[model samples]
Target: TPIKRAWIWHYQRDDRKIFIKIGNILNLNPSVVSRNFNKLERQGSDPDFYAKTSISERPRLITPHAE
Candidate 1:
């Protein structure tokens, strides 16, 4: 549910906003959220690996709207 809310806040298109939103919801420090986000970014760098992994196979927390 937290990730779901985080992803929704992500729609705001502001990293600071998303971080603050997630931090507030999780009661985490901004640094902690930044660290975790950094980890995700690192893992996501390898698109092929990420796509091949179970994480990529999980149902999306947010669905993209049809353009």
Candidate 2:
């Protein structure tokens, strides 16, 4: 459920780029990702949900350079 919780946290934060990246990595549409996150949120009853660890900072994407 940690992954699900993390997705919910990201969705709640309104991080559009993160959702796009998630969709790209998962081979899904960004809207599909958003819809799934919404479904997860509706399934959960926790009103005060927050990530166990602090993640206020945006995630950085690191790509390796080809030699």
Candidate 3:
């Protein structure tokens, strides 16, 4: 779930537009995104740390296929 990892990175960085944009591109609700991040936080998982290590690779934009 690279996208989720990316979202966490952006969230930690307070990159509002980028994280929101990621959610929009995935057709995800903002609450869903926030909740997922919160859940990880409550579990004592440092998403930012993981994201920093894992997301060193640049992210590529991916267009969703039309239904």
TM-score of each model, paired residue for residue: 0.43, 0.42, 0.36
Of 1 and 3, the candidate ahead on TM-score is 1
* Candidate with the greatest lDDT versus the true structure: 2
For every candidate, C-alpha RMSD to the true structure in Å: 9.6, 12.8, 11.2
Ten-residue segment with the worst summed lDDT in candidate 2?
A: 58-67
- Residue-wise lDDT of candidate 3 within 1-67, one digit each (tens)? 3344434544554545654665565455555444454544453432332221123333332223211
Residue 34 local lDDT, model 3: 48
Prediction 1 global C-alpha lDDT: 0.41
Query: Any idea how many clashes model 1 has?
Result: 0
Model 1 stretches astray by more than 4 angstroms:
5-14, 42-67
- Pitting candidate 2 against candidate 3, the one with the higher TM-score is 2
Ranked by lDDT, the better of candidates 1 and 3 is: 3
Cα lDDT tens digits, model 1, 1-67, are 2343334433443467665665676566655565455444443333221111224322222222211
lDDT at position 16, candidate 3: 56
Q: Pull out the clashing pairs in model 3.
A: none
| lDDT value for model 2 | 0.45
